[model samples]
Target: MDAAVAEAHVAALQGEDAHAAEPFRMSAVKFAMWLFLASEVMFFAGLLGSYLVLRFSHANQFSEEALALNWPLATLNTVVLIGSSLTMALAVSAAQAGQAPRTARFLGFTFVLGVVFLVVKAIEYSTKIHHGIVPSMSLFYASYFTMTGCHALHLIGGLVPVTVVGLRALRGRVDGGKVELVGLYWHFVDLVWIFLFPLLYLI
Candidate 1:
């Protein structure tokens, strides 16, 4: 059979129809993306729950403590994150369209943005510490550490995959929906920060 016909037939398969043909077997990659995203949902839920607990239980302390946070720095990081998300989306689009070089370029830009975010976060963390707002000092500081630290780690985690994808794009190796998948994950990381900024930093 022609490749197009075979691909069309396989693409049309659903549920048990997939088992009818070898080429129509359900995809491990697709399954993994869903499973990974489910786990990510749980992870973010836990973080948000922690934030809520700390916010309401010690509302006055948290609010008072939050007064010292640098809004200018947080706002700058927010713009950086949103920009990275845009680059990520473009990389995904380029990859889907088989423009490997463009995909690599955009992915590289996204990775650089991630690095810049981490740097800014490090600066923020340093400044906070210098001001003696250590986690041991207040419930708010502890929650801030736990929540923002986890998010920083997540941003770091996002860095690795974006770099990997960019490298693969350079080598002309990655394809399919891999770019889109990374784009989704990276966008989610950015989205999480978006919610976190106003809630934790501005509020």
Candidate 2:
């Protein structure tokens, strides 16, 4: 989308501001969310860098360790995350259209999918633990635990804001920009897993 158009969209969502020098630019909330997402990009980049280095240096061990991962379960979780992203997008679209009920329902579906992804991840983790595969087991296992565990933690952390947004949507208080902001974060989380899935499981 054109930058000006995107700016206008955000401005519309935030409502016209009387005190601003330039009107219909971008909302403060959306600006801050983009900055926050930039930081998150750097954080995940560092983790992925470290993981790639370890994997390259210990290729044989990493390959062997990767075999223990439950590919079927991880694939299912990936599908769940993808579905959540779809619902999140719908929620944003609904909110933009001022359809509060539809927005709330879509947000609820997204939340449920997020929970299901985490539950599937938990099952995978338990199986690994049962097989004595843990961070202390080896360097490969350590990287696996660190990367996947961090992503899972993020998913857990995301539940709070998603729940709040969903509740606000139900109560008819959510604005378009707010839903878009939350959707951006939710999509980023899902995108990270898209990169992670093949790296940790399929590779």
Candidate 3:
């Protein structure tokens, strides 16, 4: 009877161990990404809040300075970013479907669109600089450069992961989870620009 009890106890422990070893319902990497994004949301909220305070206090100055921004160019860049988001979605779908080549193709498209966005932004920056419009020139220009520069940096950081995942996909090693995580980040970056474009250019 003692031997039988020992065997049953060992079985119970083994079952518990197996249960503990099961994967999380949500992946660890995905959870980490969500946490990171949450922090980013708070960071941007602070920036926008500060900008709004300054903008309202200096309404006429802001309105006058906003005119210097090239809304048409910004609008074009918005469309390009939106297109990149669509391609990123397609890449995620392809990865989920285990279509590695298709995933790579879509990732390449997304990368190109992202590059186009940066190039247009660079042109806008050059024009502003040529006209002596810079961050130190005014509060409005300072906010504009700070917000857009941070967003651009995020996009540049995201491209590295996209390229890595795309290369792996090309080698028939597509990870849907990684692709989805990257998509989450890319979409967030695009969404920020969506808010920023209208706020700085149209508003």
Best by TM-score: 3
Q: Among all windows of ten consecutive residues in candidate 2, which has the lowest summed lDDT? A: 16-25
Worst 10 residues of 3 by lDDT: 16-25
* Model 2 score (lDDT): 0.90
- TM-scores for every predicted model: 0.83, 0.86, 0.87
Residues 170-199, candidate 3: write the lDDT tens digits: 999999999999999999999899888888
Please provide, for model 2 over 15-65, each residue's C-alpha lDDT reduced to its tens digit, 9 standing for 90 to 100.
765346365468888888889989999998998899888888988889887
Give lDDT for model 3: 0.92
Error of 1 at 8 (Å): 24
Residue 43 of model 1: what lDDT? 90
RMSD of each: 6.6, 7.4, 5.6
Best by lDDT: 3
TM-score of candidate 2 versus the correct structure, residues matched by position: 0.86
